[model samples]
Target: MTHGFRVASLCLSLGLLVSVVACHDNKPAAETRPAANVDVINVALRDVPVVFEYVGQTESSQQVEIRARVNGFLEKRVYTEGSLVHAGDVMFVMDRKPFEAALDAAQAELAQQKARLVTAQANLDRVRPLAAKNALSQKDLDDSVGQEQAAAAAVEGARANVIGATLNLGYTTIVAPVTGLSSFAKKQDGSYIDATNSLLTYVAKLDPMWINFSLSENEMLDLRTQTQNGTLKLPPIGKLEAVIVLADGSIYPERGYIAFTDASLSSETGTYLIRAAMPNPTGSLRPGQFVRIKLLGALRTSAVAVPQSAVQQGPRGAYVWTVDKDGKAQQRAVETGEWNGNDWVIKSGLHPGDHVVIDNTLRLMPGVPVKANLVATPPAAVNIGGPDGGATGGQQAGAAGASGPAAANANAGANAGTTAAQPTAASGASGALGEHTALYFASGSSSLDAQSADALAAVARRLVAEPGMRVAISGYTDSSGSQAANQRLAAARAATVRAALVVAGVKIERIEMRKPAQIVANDPPDKSRRVDVMFSPAAGG
Candidate 1:
C-alpha cells in the first residue's frame, strides 16, 4: 500500500514540472522588440531663396593717417588711445613757444619795413614838391619814387612772412582730420617730429563699416548658369541687402547693404570681391573683425529646402536621408545653394511630399524601416518674395491685424512675403493658392539685382495678364543716413521700380507710388530699406 502511494506523488510532481517548462517556452514576444523611431519633416515644394553666405571680414570705410604738419617736440597727448574723435578736434599739442617767437620776428620785420617805407615816402613827398617848383631835377624825383616803391614791396614781403609764421604756429597743435575712432599714437610726448614726414596716428571711420568677402570662380560660374537658366534670380546691384553675423553667432543689430562688387575675378585667388556697408553707430564692429555675411535680395524658384541638420556633407558632396513610401529611409544626393538660417536651400534632389529624416540620423541606414514622427519646421525669413505670391496689400493687412502670438508671425510675413504665412509644419493646412515673393534692398539703395529683376518680371507678367490689376510701389530707406536723404532715396527707388514695371509692359498710370505714414528707425536696415509692391485686384473683375 505504501509503495503505491509514493508512485502517485512522483507522477503529480512530474506533471507540475512539465507545465512550468511549457510556460517558459511560450514567453510573450512584445518585451523583446526594438523601438525604431525617428524625427522627420516632409519636404514641401515652394520657392526657396538663393541666399549666399560667405565668411567675411569687416574693414574701415575710411582710414585717415594723422600726421604733424609743423616740426616740433610733442608736448602733450591730448587724446586717449583708441578713442573717438571728430574732424578739427585737437588730438595732440606741440610746444608753441618757438613758433610764436618766429611769428613775432616776422611781425617785427614787417614793422621795420613799414618804418623804412614811411621815411622813403617822406623823402619822395619832399622830392615831388621840389620837382614841381623846379627845385629838384627829374632824375632825383624818379629816384625818390623808386626808393618809396621798393620800401613798400619790402613791407609786403614781410607781411607774407608773418602769415607763414602764423600758420606754422597754428600747426603746432595737431588735430583730427576726420570724424572717427582714433588709433594709438606713434610719436610719444617729448618726441621730435618732422613736419613733412612724421606719422602720429590714424583715425578710422567706423560708421558704414565695410565688410569684404569673396566667392570662387567656379561658384560664380554656377551662379551665372543658375541665373541664365531661370533657377536663381538676384536683386539689382544697389538693392542687394546684407546682414553681418558676428563671431559669437549673433546677428548685428544694424543692417548692411552691398557697397561694391569687383568687375573681374582675381587671378591669384580665383575669386570675385564683394563688399558691403554696415552701420556701426556704437562702434561695436571694428576694422579687421572676422564675421559672416548673409546676402539677401536673391530668390530660388521652385526649390526644395530641408533643415541643415538633415543634410550631411561627405567626400562626394552634400546628401540627405529621405523616407520612402514604404517607411524605409533612403540616402539621396542633393545639390545645395545657401543656408537660410537653420535650413538648407536644396537646389535639387528633393520633391514635394518627400519625407526627410531630421533627427536620429546616426542610427539610420539605407533601407532600414523607420517610424517617422513629423516635426515642425522653423519660420523662414521674410522679404524673400516669389513670382505671383508676393507681399500683397491683403497679406499686409492680415499681418497688420494679427494680434497676440500671431503678430510676430505676421510681422515676419510682412518682411519676407507670403511664404512666412505658409505652413511651417507638415500637418497644417496646404500652402497658399499662389506663389508670392518679396525682394528686399539695402539702405539708401533702390537698384535691383538679378533676383529682384526676375521677381519684377514675374510681377509684370501678372499685371499684364490682368489689365485692371494695379500695383502700388512704395520705397523705404534705413535711418543711418540723414532723414531728408532717406526720403529722396526712397522716392527715387519707387520711381525707378515704377519705370521698370512700365518697361515690363505694365501701364504707367495703373502703377501708384505710395508713401508710408511712419518710417520706423533702428529696425533691421535690410527690411527697412526695401521697395514694397502691393498688388490691387482687377478693378472691373
Candidate 2:
C-alpha cells in the first residue's frame, strides 16, 4: 500500500496524467480521510444553583477544660480517659483525708463554743434577775450579757469554718460539669496540683458539633452582585441550610443550619466567619476534622450550563466548538458564571437547545466537517448525609447531556424542579431515581482512554444483545478551568461514549441523552469528569 501511494504521488508530481479524471485517480490518501468524531452535548436553559463550597473544620460545640477546684494531691482517675461521660459523672478522686480532718476539727471547735455560750447565757439570766431585785450591781448584769453575746459570735464563726471545710471535702471528688466526650488526663495520679492553675483534661460536647468555615470577600461580593441583578435569589438568613462533606468523601448524615455568622469580615483574611451546628450524637465527627461545607439556599433561574471541558480559552475570551446544522464545527463565544459541580453556568452567548461540542477538540477546527454524535451527560452520584448522621452515597438518574431533543425535554423537567431547594435527607428525596453505575472520563479531553473505553464497550455489547433495552447517558466534568470549558468538556465526554456505542452496532434510536439532576463533584478530575450510561428495558418489551 505504501509503494502504491508513493507511485501515485510520483505520477501526480510528473504531470503524466491523460486528463483531469486520470489525475483525480492519484489523490492522496490523507485527503480522503473521514471526518473526526466529536462528542457533543445539547445546551439547555435550566436553573443552576448558586452554590459556594468552602474548606471547613469540625469542632466541639461546647469544650470545657477540666481543672482542680481546690489544691490537693491527685489520687486516682475515676473515669476512663477518652471516654464519654454525662454531667455530674465523677472524673477524678483526690485525697480526702486532710479535708475530712479539717472538717472534724471545725465541728469540735463549734461544740466548744456552744458550751461556752450555754454557761454565759445562764450567768446572764441569773445576774439580770438578781440585779433587778437590788441583790447585784447593774454592771454585773451588763458584763454577763456581753459575755453571752461574745460566746454566740464565736459559735457563729466556728459554724462558718465547718461549712467551708465541708465544701473543700466535697471538692476533692472532681466531677464532669457537662455531658460530653472526655480527653486523656493531663495530670497523672499522685501529682500535686494547684487549684487555680492546674489543667487536668478537657470534656467536649459532641452531640451538636460546630462546623466552622469562612467566605472570602470576593465570594461575598460576587453573591451580592448576583442577588442584586436578579440572577440569584437567596434564602432568608435564618432558613439557610448547611451540608458537610467529610474527609473520606462521605457527607455527614444530619443536616445543619447556620448557628452564627460574624457581623463583620475579618481584617486578617478579609473573609466573613460562619459557623453551623450539626448533630453528632454518635461522636463520629471529631474536633479538628477537615470538611467541606456546602451552603444551600441561593437559586439561579434560567441559567444555561454545559460541561467545563467544552469551553476553550483564546485571545477573544472563552469560546466552545459547536456543531452547526451542516455537521460542521463552529466557534461560539460565551460568557460564564460560577461553577455548579463539574458543569459551568453559561451566562450569555448561547441559547437553549444549542448543540455544544464537548470532546476531541485537540484536532478540531472551525468549519471542519465533524461526525458529531449526540450523547447524554452521565448521571452524577449525589451522596447525601444519611438519617443516622452517616453518608449514604447514591447516584442520581436522568441527567441528560447537552444534545438532541432529549436534552431539551430533560432541561424542562430540571427547570420545573429548580424552584425548590436541592433535595436531601431532610427534603423528602429518599425515593428519587438513582443510578447504579457511573461513567468516568479522562483529563482535559472527552476522548475515552483504554479503561473507560473498555467500560463503555461492555455497555455497547449489552445494548447490542438486548434489542429491547434503552440507555440514558449524562456527562460531567471536574472543576479545573473556566465554567464554560468544563461544561463543554463534560458534554464531549458524553457524546464520545455514545459514538463508541453506535460504532459497536447499537441502534441510535434506542439511546437517550439526559441532563443529570446534579453534577458529580469528586477529586482527581478523572473521577468527577465522567459520562453515566444506564440501561433500561424498552417500553412493552
Per-model TM-score on C-alpha atoms: 0.52, 0.55
**Model 1 root-mean-square deviation:** 24.1
lDDT of 1 at 345: 74
lDDT by residue for model 1 (250-271), tens: 6688888898989997653344
293-410 per-residue lDDT for model 2 (tens digits): 6667666766787877888899989898888999998999997654445567776899877889899998788888989899996332222332112110110111111222332332
List per-prediction Cα lDDT, in the order shown.
0.68, 0.67
Candidate 1 TM-score versus the reference: 0.52
Best TM-score among the predictions, by candidate number: 2
Among these predictions, the greatest lDDT belongs to 1
* Candidate 1 residue 153 C-alpha distance from true site, Å: 3.5
